[model samples]
Target: MLARHHDPIAAIATAPGRGAVGIVRVSGHGLAPFVQALLGRALRPREAHYLPFPDAQGQPIDRGLALFFPAPHSYTGEDVLELQAHGGPVVLQLLLARCLEAAQGTAGAAGTAASVLPHLRLAAPGEFTERAFLNGKIDLAQAEAIADLIDASTAAAARSAGRSLSGAFSEEIHGLRDALVHLRMLVEATLDFPEEEIDFLRKADARGQLSKLQHMLATVMQRAQQGALLREGIKAVIAGQPNAGKSSLLNALAGAELAIVTPIAGTTRDKVQQTIQIEGVPLHVIDTAGLRDSSDEVEKIGIARAWEEIAAADAVLFLHDLTRQNQPDYVAADAAIAHTLAERLPPGVPVIDVWNKTDAAPGVQPGSAPGHEAVRLSARTGEGLDTLRHLLLEAAGWQPAAEGLYIARARHTEALRAVDAHLMEAAAQLESSGPALDLLAEELRLAQNALGAITGEFGADDLLGVIFSSFCIGK
Candidate 1:
């Protein structure tokens, strides 16, 4: 009966391509009859039966184990079936066809056709998780956590994602919601009584409650920002004048020649990006075109794009040649470039100066710190790379802790920020002599709604569709 939401979805729950075992999962109403059509019997719920998957005309296409999960306890909270078959692409296709045929033919207890069944629909990216959210099996934040866990590149990232999936993030939001609800009750109570007897407006306790709520919201928002950083990582761009060893540095840091390096000024025109994990922090290293004035149309376009990259970069590496230091023009050029780029870069973006090719210049060792904040390094010799890495991590505000982190996305962080904003507004209203009760209540409601979005409590059907559509078909 639950299948009325749409078509039943199917997809290979296992990863694509060859494996020791492949699973094709089907979930929705009328799934039992479909399984019976192939297995040829009424199998007990939650029981695994080794049966031959029959094709049309009751012919066996492949033999495998079939497990039936009755509705209400299944992953999708619907009648679900799993057919485990040999990991052959063709073989799995045949089994899927058999399941589809069975699903199409089954009728519900009602005389009408079981149109509630999803008609063998394709599952979107994260549809199963979406269904689980709709069924109250998990909240919205947990559903997003599933995606983060799948895409985690480091152990810390995965661990954080797992914690989120386990409801660490949602629990905090729920706690905040409970506090807000209680505060709203006390504030609204003042409206029900006569002004003279209503001591609510003058109560010190009410003001204290508002203060506490604001502090709590601020704390949670700060942590959510840090969690987002760990999940999204940073985009660090290497930008400088031509032949400043940008390509060499990219190769050295990546431990591979991802970019072509030569004495040629425009050897690197396009951007090359490598996602690297340094001690579990995901870093997106972008090697951009060397910023310079060019006459060639293509090179000019590339240089302009390089500046764009620099503008958006979380951090910029303004590399320079150390040997050219004595030349007055060289010093003026570097200073001018730095000042110009600073105007274009986003506010708060940290630009680190890197003096490369220092091996050729005496008194420049990997451990030696330059008079400026810049680091002296030889990308070719792999010296001072560690210092650069540490600096990048420090810029990200990443500090290794024994535990207590969870994976979070920018969306989740935004929601938390929204909640914090509303809470602050509510606090401000409560403090006013003529209590802005209406505005305070409205802000409290907004805060609750923001928190609800994290767990699917405030999401729309279309939002659910978009979220779940990303999952594999049979998931």
Candidate 2:
């Protein structure tokens, strides 16, 4: 896989389909000659030139702007060429094909493109960004952020991804790494002089330094956890008995009539989904079919699917009808749902009691179930929704947004956790009655390695492949 990184790659850099403009990009070592060969004229470095990209027969494939960036200064630390042309698919394809033909020593009407760059081929998905990472132009974190920024579901997510791309997250990792290195050096120096090992670490304030490092890691972990929430929002499933205002709550939360709401029971025969953001944290709220024992075959299927969704939910909003509190049958059905919730809900998925239609039953004190948050709201009047939104965010484990936050992934949080554990081990070793300098040193080393993995300072080729393979072609 590493050997494949050396191959020159070309790709259409724009999103698929028609647009006002599209881009065809190529990156490789010593591409200046290739640029001249393909364009029939040498391009000024880092300058855009108006030109017509010619084919093997020298006919214009598309007239557009071509820009060149020389090696060690480009995105991949290699020579790069970009052609901005009309966004039509066929026009970009012809230009790309011409570049390939020219790479194979095919001569156009004006000049020969032979041997300028050999073995030119189509870029694999994320190959372009992967090269940038491998070449040290951007670290692994920043490379991942490129995709994150593109796939961001909210403005906050996009901003955080941009911060990460600008190396905000990498900078934090580097800071932790530098501190760890200093502490490692101090411990190793102490190990070298066994006669005064304890006293040496003692005078150097190594414990104090380690304490500071742990504190720093904690801050990063908290920020990364919140950022991961932005990247990966939780699934929130709304469920209850028929006419319990399940669809009404969903519509109210989504601020649109997404789910069909009626006085009739089983109006929603399927799930209605909407992605709503609370403080820039996305929640994929799904209103599943009401749960009940239905004789109709179709209603039974819907109810079964509702259980499926309930089992899979990150948190279940078991909405209860406030007006039906006095009805004995309604109470039993609600209890049945609570039992199924306990039986089927994945462990750790919170079950919140949402008392709907509070406007009709003002000041109704619905009995709160022992392990679930109770919220009273009138979905029709849009009251108590703010409280529900806050509770949902709380249930998702999202903290208040921190300043200078950067988007992070699940792997990042896991890596940080590993670093924290290693640091804790090192601290314990330091605090031991007869601390083994070697164990302390080893723990610190592992912690640094974990930190290095976050920014590509330490990682395997397979890890690199998995990270970059997730990106779209042409970065």
Candidate 3:
């Protein structure tokens, strides 16, 4: 347990900027003394008291609403006080300073109560939410959902995070755990009564239960993969020869002139990145320097960086200039780049062949040709862009879930995979000629532990620290 939980923590909860209102929040045990010292009166629990927030000199610093939530009923399961004031940065800072002063007995004799509010300090990042987790107000997954909701980049992602925060994900995990516990009980009972094991095991249907659990686990794992994609968008690298309309496609997809485009072969000498959403699935489009031999030292460096990006990308779009495809030199160059891409790109990373400038090269058909699967589109005229969008989603193996998804992280997906692996091992044990109940029971236990880790029911302190530290303070 963290010792700082005993200390009172205060911070400016609202974002730092000029707004109609700002809030200074404090959380700890027994905040009545501090509240009385700051507001000059006791506040009714769960009630908003419109009053003057006075300073040490009994001067009204700013009049705003003061809301108080008593212990066991507040966000952190402690006494939490929120002072809403003007959103000016200085005003919030002054209010925060006064809060610290009042908590530390820095005011006059009337405010001296060190025992009531001892060790008043600033909160670390996510300490407030961490306290809520520790106090059982929310579990670890829900706490993570709090941060995910705030950082959501899309409407779909925000909704998913909201669902997860509402304990949708935790409830599912708990339900699965309960089922595992029931199975474990049955298996262990058989071990204790070997004489009656045959009839007991037959009636218990351990194999059938395990199969059902495995199926359910697979379903959850699939949903988690989609949620993880929403949280961490796919990185797609655009690579091709110089003047292949890579920048043009980026600008068209983004619906803005984000990247400078020109007819010059080496116009884009560096990577130009733009994130665009197709059906709430973010595609981080990286338009890299065109691949080709160049005497310009800077262009060579850019080309090298482009290859590096391609190697790390989840997908690569090899754009081809349709107008120049008939030329022998251009064809040879395109073939050479294609050969290099096949050799250099990481295995399993999909590469999409895109023929650009379809408007200039009319009568050219789109779709799979002799050598590659291609999508022909005119980035300038906005033709065949929708097909490319669908293709990108398909290449990433993204299938739109029929039901709502709970926002999940990479770690959640990894844990689910671990659980699946253990379940597979357990299934293999059950199918053996002489089924080993001992080994099957151990495998189920391992699976339970892996699933529990998702909700912090069986997680290390270091894992909790890493998760919470990523959140902003006052959460």
- lDDT winner: 2
Q: Write the per-residue lDDT of candidate 2 for residues 238-326, one digit (tens) a residue.
A: 99999888888888989998988788888889888999898999999999998888898999999888888888898999999888899
lDDT ranking from best to worst? 2, 3, 1
Instruction: Supply the TM-score for candidate 1.
Output: 0.90
Q: Write the per-residue lDDT of candidate 3 for residues 1-475, one digit (tens) a residue.
A: 7687788899988876899999999998889988988778999999988988888777888999999999899999989999999899999999999898887677464455554566889988899999999889999999999999999989888998999999988998998899898988898888998777656867888889988998888788888888887888789999999889999999999999998988888999899999889888889999999998999999999999999999999998989889987789998898898889888977888888999998999976544424355688999999989999988888887887546888999999999989999989988987777778888889889999998899888889899999989988777
Model 1, CA-based lDDT:
0.76
- Which consecutive 10 residues in model 2 have the weakest lDDT in total? 107-116
Give me the runs in candidate 3 sitting further than 4 Å from their true place: 113-115, 194-199, 366-373
TM-score of 2: 0.94
Question: Model 2 segments beyond 4 Å from truth?
Answer: 293-304, 342-348
- Each candidate: what lDDT? 0.76, 0.89, 0.87
Against the true structure, whose TM-score is highest?
3
State the displacement of the C-alpha of residue 465, model 3, in Å, after optimal TM-score superposition: 1.0
Models 1 onward score TM values of: 0.90, 0.94, 0.95
